[model samples]
Target: MAIHELAVNAVKYGALSSPEGHVTVVWHVEDRDGAQCLRIEWTETGIPVIAHAPRRSGFGTELLTQTVPYQLRGTSTLTFKPGGLQCIIELPAKGVLQ
Candidate 1:
């Protein structure tokens, strides 16, 4: 549940972190191998990136992997870019949310 994680982060360490800190979540779809794949990106502008990977077990990470692919029948990949984290989840074109 990205929505849930976003909410939690907003309350804990996201937009509310400071007046200048902000987070953006976006998604789109494209055709790949005759199927539609969902590409989602999460960008945090003001948070510091102290580690290369998640420090502890967390629901956000778990949900990002499990819920998106298993539940939605998709494939997902994540990358830590220069500015923020990017996640791309690919699902069957049929029955997807968008």
Candidate 2:
């Protein structure tokens, strides 16, 4: 999936919603339980605040909860913290192309 959508969504409502907010994405290939896998950590900082999760799901939620995992055979978890949102994704490295 094109990350542009995700970035756009973030800019519109999530991490990038505020001028001071920032997003950091990091991914690496490593051995987990003896299996090669790609682990991604998405962290958001400087968010004004996080009251709670959205009552309704939207494109961002769908992409993170459904699209990325189902399409890429990955497992993902999204957490909403008072500080910011944190997303973690891990997938088989064999399925990835470099």
Candidate 3:
């Protein structure tokens, strides 16, 4: 769901907004304390800078801070770069099938 939201945003306002725009989504796993951790990244380029963070209160912000984490059992961080947005999500790998 978070991926979908990010994709939609990219299409509506981020990397996909212009001819030079682009978006990248990647993920990997790391071992920590004998447990696996899944890390996902979403990056956007070619978007204009509007705000340092998401709006104070909105559906997007709500999802970023609450819904996504609840559903994935993970935590997320957002960074706005000169080009666009970057998001990182980290999740525990326990009980998850490969």
Candidate 4:
């Protein structure tokens, strides 16, 4: 659901809006602060330019910033770079991993 929202936004107003733009999604398990975590990085590149972050928070922003951290006890960050946007999400990987 989180990832889907990202893709939706990307297609509507992000790098995906541009003909030459691209989006990359990657994930891995790693240790953070002595705890194992599943880190997912969503990156957008090849955008012509990005003026700045959105002026207001949307449902996607609330989900990433509030819901994920509060409900899943994870962490997330949304960054607007010169060329595109980058979102990093880290979720606890305790019993979920085998």
Choose the strongest candidate by TM-score.
4
Pairs of residues clashing in candidate 1: none
lDDT of each: 0.64, 0.78, 0.78, 0.90
Candidate 4, residues 1-98, lDDT tens digits: the string is 68889999989888799998999999999988899999999999877768688789999999999988888888999999878889999999986578
lDDT by residue (tens digit), candidate 3, 1-98:
77778888788777887888888889999997898988889888777764566556556657876976798787888898677889898888875547
Count clashing residue pairs in model 2: 0
Q: After superposing candidate 1, which stretches have Cα over 4 Å from the reference?
A: 49-51, 78-83
By TM-score, the better pick of 2 and 4 is 4
**How accurate locally is residue 14 in candidate 3, as Cα lDDT from 0 to 100?**
76
Worst 10 residues of 4 by lDDT: 46-55
What ranges in model 3 sit over 4 Å off?
49-51
Q: Candidate 1, TM-score vs. the true structure?
A: 0.70
Each candidate structure's TM-score, on Cα atoms with residue i matched to residue i, is 0.70, 0.83, 0.84, 0.89
Clashes of each: 0, 0, 0, 0
lDDT of 3: 0.78
